[model samples]
Each structure stands twice: as C-alpha cells, then as structure tokens.
Target chain A: MRRVVITGQGTINALGRNVAETLQAMRDGRCGIGDLEFQDVERLSIRIGAQIKGYEPEDSFNRQQIALYDRFTQFTLLAAREAIGQSGLSFSGELATRSGVILGTSGGGMNTLDENYRSVYADGKNRVHPFVVPKLMNNAAASHVSMEWNLKGPSFTVASACASSNHAMGQAMQMIRTGMADVMITGGSEAMLCFGGIKAWEGLRVMSKDACRPFSANRNGMVQGEGAAVFVFEDYERARTRGADILAEVVGFSMTSDAADIVMPSKQGASRAIAGAMQDARLNPEDVAYVNAHGTGTTANDKTECAAVADAFGHHADDLMISSTKSMHGHLIGGTGAVELLACIMALREGVIAPTIGYEEPDPECALDVVPNVARDVKVNAVLSNAFAFGGLNAVLALRAA
Target chain B: MSDSIKDRVIAILAEQAMLEPGDVSMDQSLEDLGIDSLGLVESIFAIEEAFDVSVPFNANDPTEGDFDISSVKAIIEAVTGLVATQAA
Candidate 1:
C-alpha cells in the first residue's frame, strides 16, 4: 500500500474562518459557544451553540453557485477551496481525473428543508424553490465540491452521524493507499443551526443548556455547532516530488461498529477502533503523545471514551495528553471528526496540544488529563483522533509528524 | 385585555418568526413583518390555540394581502369576533 500524507488543511467554525484563526483561538483557550442569535425561539433553554459568524456565500461562490448550494454545501466548498489553495495543487487534465472528493454530513441541508417545509405545509404553497431538491440532498456538499474543483474520481458523501467525517477521511486514505486516487479532498460540513434544526435536536434532549464542558463534573451535555473542515491528502512520493508542504502523515485509520445501543456509547467499540488504528499505524501505545478524544461534553460520552482510552492504552492512557477541541468549538456533529483531525495534525506539526476548554471540575469517572483549559507545549510525534457517532459507529485515525 | 397577555403574544411572535417585538406593530401587516405566508398561517394557528378562538380565513383566497391579519390586537379582535359569531 502507498503511504498517504496530508498536504493541506482548512477549517471554518465558530472559532474562526480559517485554520490559523481557529488554531489561535484553540491555543488561547477560547470557548466559542454563546447565546445563539441566528433565529428566535421561545424560551429555549438550549440557547448556546457554536455558530459560524460573518459568513457570506458571495465571498466563496458565484451567484449561480449560491442558488444551487445549501449552507452546508457552501461551507464544504469554502473549506475545500482553502485546502486546495494551500496545497498548491492545480486541478488540470489528468490530475483532476485522478483526484476524488469525499465529504461527510449528518443533517444535510436541514435549514433548507425546514424553510421549505414551513413554506409548503404551513403556507399551503404549491410552488417550491427551484433549488430545494439539490440543496437538501446529502450528496449535495460533495457534489458541489467536486464540481467546484472538477474532481472525477470516487466522489461521494458519508453519513455516519458524528463519525461522518472520519469515515470520509478513512475512505479517502484507503483510496490513496490502494492507488485508486493519487489525491483526495475529504472532510465534513454541518450547518444545522437553523430554527427547525435546533428544535429537532432539542427533541433529543442531549444538548447542553450552557457551554460544552467535556470531562467536567458540571458537564450537562453536548452543545451543537456548525462548520466545515477539509484536508488535502496525497501519496507521500507524489507530494514530495511535487515539493508539496507535508502537514502530517496519515499513519493509520480504523473503523468499527459497536452493534450495541444506538444512542448509548460503547467502550468496547471505541477501544477496538483505537487498538486497530494503532496496529494499522505499526505504533505502540507508548509512541502516541496526544489523543484528540471524541469527548462530546456529555456524561455518557466522556465516561465511555475515557474507559475506551484506558482499555486501549492501559498505563499509557494516563501519560498521553488527551483533549477535546469540541469544548471550544462545540459539537459540529458530522464535521467534528475532520476538524478534530486537523487539531491532531496541527498538534503533531506545531508541537502544541490544543486544550479542552471549559473543563473546570473534572469528573472522577473521566480521569484523563484532558489538557484542561490551557494549551500545552509538547513534542507530539504521533497523534490520534477518535470519533464515535450515534448508531454504534466509531472511527479512529492516527497521524504522525511528517 | 391585560398587558401581560400582550407581552406574551408579542414574545411568542418574536420567538416563532425570529422577529423583534418592535417589528410587529398594531397596524403593520403580518407579511410586512417578514412573516412569510407560512409564518402567517403558523402564527394564526398558534394564536387560535393560544386564545382558544377560531380564526376564519377565506379558503379561496391565499395571498399576503388576504392575510390582513395585522397586529396582536387585530388578531384578538378577529378571535373575539369569531367567538361571538359562533355563540350567536
């Protein structure tokens, strides 16, 4: 199998619009959750969310493109544009055909669906918007990204709830490793901050009323967020020959199914994913310096994930610096894994572990270090990002310094 | 009839449609308040349930102008009229 390495990374979240701004916010331990001002809701206890501010479609796409794309698709396009731009990879001729795009999203175009539903059901309107179908589809984000960059190989979207992006990136890595594609643009995007979207999540009753406080004793639940993060992955030899700036090497990736409860997390499933990823990377637990946990600030998730880490790493679990960037960015749901993967890459490259902000009082059940509320300078040779989604899906990716 | 009722109605309207209370006035058309046709329908539905009154709409006419259903006061008036008519 060919070796895959990350050449570029891009992200747009509540923290910032690009990778640098986001990384700075993470290092500074800024919590992006606040009173959601996007839509008015009646006495909603769940008022805080990590909403992307100051985003305009005109800044990223043309008028025609904007008409066909939903907010999630627009976000994916923006992140992909930044990743491509940073990679300096020209999508021309054979390269375009040899490249692919894979994206992940759970609640795709929910805002569009909510608006149109209101228009049709409540207003008794027969006419729907011309772009509603294209805007509401799950594949729309990947389709938009592919069309924007003219990628022809193996383009599709993965929907594994929160693990969506990890599944997408893992598949993209497999494609490159198996020589199916020389390069792939892969990531996830989520824009479920609309009125109806929040209402739907409110029914789940797992969202926090305040800021996300992962691993904290006072943690209530996950705070919903919206954003997109994408990475440009290419074969190491091709990247080196092209003099591409290697961000990090995709050392390992593993996916597992708990086959257990739908909403309740499984420690065994998460442990298997971590063990499998470590095996795939040919690295022992001692080699890992940091772990970007799938800590969603929920009581069940933090405890279960900490147990999984302990099961996978044994004594090394205490030594490894574990943190959840979700504490600052809120939970991006589908896009979270990709964004957290970028955190891992940044940690491995910059030798700085981003903190799990909002962690005040640690829960005894979740006794990991969690790098609470403050960024730490560490020599990270290898970093692991874990993403556990609903429906028993779990994905883990290991990244090494290039 | 009371200030509290008015405030509650206004708060619900603002929350449901993401509008400011100031945007909804006594004489302004609901449509003009950025309450789309669906929003108008939902608001009417919510108001009817809230006040326990039936709001009559001409089934044949479904336009923004048709929904002259203006302010909270106008809504209360329509509901009261509908209730009186039903009683008669």
Candidate 2:
C-alpha cells in the first residue's frame, strides 16, 4: 500500500480566504460570528452567522461558467484554485486522467434554489432558470470542480452532513492507498447563509443568538458558517520526486455510524472512530498531541464529544490539547471537517495549537483543556481531526508532521 | 379587512418563509424578496392553518399554485376567490 500526504492546502472561511490568512486569524483568536444580514432575515430571532464576506463569483469563473454554477460551487472552485496553485503541480497530459476530485457539501446550490423558487412561485412566472438542476444538486460542487480542473478519475461528492469532508478525505486516502488513483483533490464547501437557508435552521432551534461558545459553561449553540477548504493528496514517493512542499502525512482515517439517534450524538460512536483511526495509523493514543474537536457549541454536542475524548484516551484526555476551530469559524456543516483538517495540518506544521475562542466558563461535563481562548505554542508531532454529523455519522483523520 | 384575516395573512408569511413583520408587506411581491416556489406551497399550508380555510388548487397544473404569489395581497386574492366559490 502506498502512503498519502497532503502536499498543498487551501481554505476560505469567515476568517480568511487562504491558508495563511486563515491560520493567522486562528492564531490571533478571532471570532467570525456576527449579525446575519442577507436581505431577508430581519424577522428570525437567530441572526448571527459566520458568513464569508467580499467574495465575488465573477472573480473565480468566466461569464458562461458563472451562470452554470452557484455560490457553493464558486467557493469550491476558488478553494481548489488555491490548493492546486499551492501544490505547484499541473495536470497537463496523463496526470489529468489519473487525478480526480472528491468534495463534500450539504447546502449545495440552496442559494440558487431560493432565487429560482422566487422567480417561478412568488413572481407568478412560468419560466425557470436554465441552471436550476445543476445548481441545486448536492453533487454540483464536485461536478463543477472536476469539470473545471479536468479531473477524470473517480470524481464524486460525499454527504455525511458535518462529517462529509472528513469522510471524503478518508475515502481519497483509501483510494490512493489501495492503488486506485495517483492523485486526488478532496475538500468541502458550503454557502448556506441565504435567507431561506437561515430560516430552515431556525426550526432546529440549536443556533446561538449571541455567539458560539463551545466547551464553555455558558455555551448556547452553534452559529452557522459558510466557506470551503481543499487539499491536494498525492503518493508520498511521487510528491517527494516532484520536490513538492509536503504539508503533512495522512497517516490514518476511520469512520463509524451510531445507529442510536437522529439528532442526538453518541460518545461510543465518536470514541470508536477515534480509536479506530489511531489503530489504523499503528500509533498509540499517546502519540496524538492535538485534537480538532467537532465542538458544535450545542449543549449536547460539546458534552458528548468531551466524554468521547475522555473515553478514547483515558488519562491522556486531561493532558491532550484539544480545541474547536468551529468556535472561531462557526459550524460550516458539511465543510466543517475539511476546514478543521486544515487547522490540524497547520497545528502539526507550525507547532502551535489554535485556541477554542468564546470559552468563558468551563462546562463541568466538558473538562478537557480545549486550549481555552488563547493559542498555545507547543512541539506537536501528530494531530487528530474529529467530525461527528447529524444522524450519527462520525469520521476521524490522523495526520503527522512531515 | 377583518383583523383575523389580516393576522392570518401575516402569520402565514411569517411561519412559511420565516419572515418578520418589517420584512413583509401586504403590497410587496414575494418574488422581489426571496420566497421561492417551495416556499409558496408551504405558505399555502400556513394560510390554511391560520384562517381555517383551505385554498382550492388546480389539480391539473400543480405549477400554477406557485405563480404570482409575491405579496400578501396576491395571496389574499387567491384565497378569497377560492373561499367565495366554495361558499357558492
């Protein structure tokens, strides 16, 4: 089996548009949650969201392409551009055939759906937009990315809710390890801050009215966020021969499902997923230093996740430096895992753990360090990124410093 | 207009599209704002619940239900028309 490593990474979120800016924002302990103002959410009691500001679709695609794609696809393309550019590899000839794209998204083309719905129903118009199907499908982002980048091998989208991206990455690593593909572009994107989307979340009643405060005693609930994160994964020897800048090694990945509940999370499922990843990497729990928690800031998720960590690592749970980058970026739903993975790679490379901001009071149920409010500089060797989604989907990835 | 009728229209818009009072106007077109076709159908259900009246639908063309449903005025017109015919 061949080993896989992340040669390049790119991200766009409430914090920044690229890896450098995003990492800097995380280090500076910035919170991206703010009042939601998308021209239609004036009545909803919950208004705050981590929206990506100043992004234009025209900047990433041509006029014809823009008409075919939605905001979520635009985000995927922009993040893919950054990842491929950073990787310094071109898909010119056979490379294009061998390379593939895998992306995850939950709110695929919701914004487009919102627009077309208004045109047909509210306006009493019979004519629908031309790109409605292409825009609204959940796989549209992956399809757009593959077509834009000319990736022909095994391109598809994964939708495991919040765990979608991590599951996509895990599948990409397996494909390479099993000699299925030579190279893969994997990540996730979301653009669900539209008025209709926000209203849908309001019914769930898990949104934080003030701000997202994960692992804090005063935690309310998660603040919705939007953006994309992508990574270039190549075989280790292939990357080394090309003199590519290796960011981190994809040592192991694991996924598990808790057949327990629809919305409620389970510690057993989360713990098993983490342990399974560690076993896959052939590393003990002690080898893992930093943990990027799911940490959705909800009353149940935070406490349940903390218990899972403690159950997985035993005594090391108290000492392990865990933090939820979601506290900074808010929950990106499907894109959350991919962005959190970028934070893991950064933590492993820079030897600094990003803090879980908005952690005011410590929840007695969540007793982990959580790297609370301030970034910590430490010599980290390996990191774990955890993503647990609704309906009991759980995925975990283990990365080591290259 | 009866207070119940006005309240029913407002309530339908608020519940179906998650709109607030300031964001919605009786004369405003729903298309100009953001409520889509799915939103319109959902709003119809909300209207039924609010006014204890079931708006008639054209079973032949399901798509017709979504067209021209922009403002509360348009919705009221559609619903009142249906109610009058049903009474007759």
Candidate 3:
C-alpha cells in the first residue's frame, strides 16, 4: 500500500483568490460573509451570503470558453491550475495514464441552470444555448480538470450534498493508497450564489439574514457561500523522490450515515465518524489538537456538532481547540470541506489555528473553546476536518503534519 | 375576530398537525397540536398564503419574530393584525 500526501493546494473563495491570500485572511480572522449581490436578491428574505465579489469570467476565460464553462467549472479550473502548477508534475506517458481527477460539487452548474430556466420559462424563449447541458452537468468540473491536466485515468464527480468534497478527496486518497492511481487531482467547487440557488435554499428557512456566527448563542442560521478549492494528492514516495513540497499527509477518512431524518443531524452518527477517523489514522484522541468543525451556525447543527465532538473525544474534547472556518467564509455547501481543509493544512504547517469568528454570546451547549473571534498561534501535530451534510451523511478526515 | 380567518387558520394548522380541524382549539398551542419546528414553518407559509399577507417570521428564534405562536388564538390575532395592515 502506498502512503498518500498532498503535494499542492489552491483555492478561490469569498475570503481570498488564492491559497496565500486565503490563509492570510484566516490568520487575520477576516469575515467574508456579507450582503449578497445577485439578481432577485432583494426578493429573498435572507439576502446575505459569502459571495465571491468582483469576479469577472471574461478575465479568466475567452468568450467561447465562458459560454461552454459554468461558473462552478470555471472556479474548479482556476483552482486546479494553481494546484497542478504548484505540484510541478506534468501529465504525460505513464504518469498521465496512471493519474486521474475527481472533484465534488453540489450544484454543479446552478448559474447555468438558473439562466436557461429563466430563458425558457420567464423570458418565454423557445430554446436555450446548445452547451447548456454540458456546462451544467454534475461531472463538468471533474471532466474539465481531467481534460485540462490530461489525466487519462479514472475521472468522476461526487455529490453528497455538503460532504461532496470530503467524499471525493477520500476516494482520491484511497485510489492512490491502493495503487489504483499514482496521483489524483481532487477537491471541490461550488458556485450556487445565483438567484435560483438562493431562492431554493430560502424555502428551507435555514439561512441567516446576516452573518454566519457558528458556536455563538446568538447565532441564527447558516449563511451560504460560493467558491472552489483544489489539491494534488500523490504517492508519498513519489512526491518525496521528486522533491515536491508536501503540504500534509493523507492520513485517514471515515464516513457514516445516520439513517434517521433527512435534514436533521444525528449526534451518534457524527461521533461514530469522528471516532472512526481517529481509529483509522491510529491516532489517540490526545494526539489530535484542532478540529475544523462543520459548524453551519444553524440552531441544530452547531449544538449537534459540538455534542458529537465531545462524545468522540471524551475528556480530551475539553482540551482540544475546535473552530469552524465557515464562520468566516460561510458554508460553501459541497465546496465547504475543501475550503475548510485549507484551515487544517494551515494548522499543520503554519501553526496557526483559524478562529470561529462572529462569536458573541456564549453558548452553554457549545462550551468548548471555539477559539472565538481571534486567531490563535499553536503548533499542532494532527487535526480533523468534519463535514456533516443534509440527509445525515457524515465524513470526517484526519491529517498529520507533513 | 374574523370567522373566516379563524376557520382557515384552524384548517391550515390541522393539515400540518395531521389532526381534525375540530380538534384544534384557540387555547391550544402549536406544541399541543404536535406541530414541530418544520410544521410551524409550513403553517406560517400556509397562513400567509391564505390571507395573502406576508408574515414576518424567522425560525432562528420563533419568539423574536413579530408573529406569535403561543396559542391558536395568539396566532389568529397576529394574522388578523397583518391582514388589516396589508389591507390599509
């Protein structure tokens, strides 16, 4: 079995445009959630989100490419470019045949769907653009990455709602570890900040009208966000032999389903996944330092996740630092875990723990140190990133310092 | 109190609570009717549609919202007020 390591990483989110900028913002505890700007936003009761403002498609892609690529695909490509460039491994010959790509996305081309729906239904147009199907498909981002990088091996997209990225990355790690592939270009992307996207989510009544204040007693609900984060996962020996900069080690991943309610989370299910990930990594609870929580700021999620963490770590839960970066970047849905994974890597490499910002009133249920409202400087050996999505799907990933 | 509004509210609550309209009483609270958070939200939406008046509600803190769900009568009063205001 081959050991997997993350050789390169890239991201573009509400907080920043690239890895450096994003990490710096995390260190600064900056909040990217604010007033959402999109069509029919004024009509929505919840009119705020962590949208990537001032982004122009024309600047990154030609007219034809823009027409063919959806916003989510574009974001994935941009992050993939940075990640693959950082890895410095060209895809050709045997390497290309042995490498692959897998990306995660919930609303694959929501913007494209929203536009075409409007064209046919609202605007009374008879036909939509010819590329609409290809642009809006769920596998578009993964397919584009495979084509762009010439990854001739396995390629697909995973969609498990919010846990899509973690599942996708976990699959990539398994592929490399089992000698299924030499390298896997993997991560997640989401651009669902469009009118139809927000409007659909608004019906759920789980969105905050203002900020995402995870773990705060005053927290109302989750704020939506949009972005992408991509990474290169290669065999550890291969990366070391090539002198590639290893970001973090792909250690362990565990996924669980509650088999309970669809929208509600189960503490037992989450705790199982948390404990299972640690068991898989052969890491004791004390060995872990920080946990990037799936704190969605919702009345149910924040408390439920806190309870799960406490149950999994037992007494050590009191000593460990757990923070939700979603408080800063907002919940990116399927793309969230990948962006949140950046915080885990930062804790391992930079010794900086991202804070759970917007903390005000203390939540007795979430009594653990949330590292509230201010970044902390701490060297950590192992960290866990948790992603629990709707439908009771839970995926927990463990990483060690490289 | 408008009789039609009361009847319509009771019908909506009954539908959501999965009970007979006759079983719902003005003294009964949403909890008494077995209306959970999701059911309460759906009831609110139904009430707003029935009267064609927007109900200012945020499920984050149901108590903080202007709409009152303390009891059936309280909800009727809030809806009546909203309906009158919209008519004005």
Could you give me the TM-score of model 2 versus the true structure?
0.82
Real contacts recovered, all predictions: 0.00, 0.00, 0.45
In candidate 1, what are the lDDT values of residues A1-402, reduced to their tens digit?
999999988888999999999999988999888878764565454678998877788987789887888989888877888899999998879989899999999999988898899889988999998989989999999988788788988899999999999999999999999999999999999999887888767545567776788898888778888999999999999999999999999989999999988778899999999999999999999999999999998778889999999999999998989999998888888999988887898798898899998888868889989999999999889989999999999999999999
Checking candidate 3 for backbone clashes, the offending pairs are none
Interface RMSD, in order shown: 18.6, 16.8, 1.3
Model 2 per-residue lDDT tens digits across residues B1-88: 4556666676677666677766777887766556654465567667666556655432122333443454677776766665555557
Give a tens-digit lDDT track for model 3, residues A102-158.
888999999999989998999999988899999999999999988888999999999
- TM-score: model 3, chain A: 0.99
What CAPRI grade goes to candidate 2? incorrect
Q: Point out the worst 10-residue segment of candidate 3 chain A by lDDT.
A: A202-211
Candidate 2 residue-wise lDDT, A332-394, digit = tens = 999999999878987889988999999899678999899999999998888999999999999
Best model per lDDT = 3
Instruction: Please give the distance, in angstroms, between residue B38's alpha carbon in candidate 1 and its true position after superposition.
Output: 33
DockQ in order: 0.02, 0.02, 0.63
Name the top DockQ candidate: 3
Per-prediction TM-score: 0.82, 0.82, 0.98
Best by TM-score: 3
In model 2, how large is the Cα lDDT of residue A388?
Answer: 95
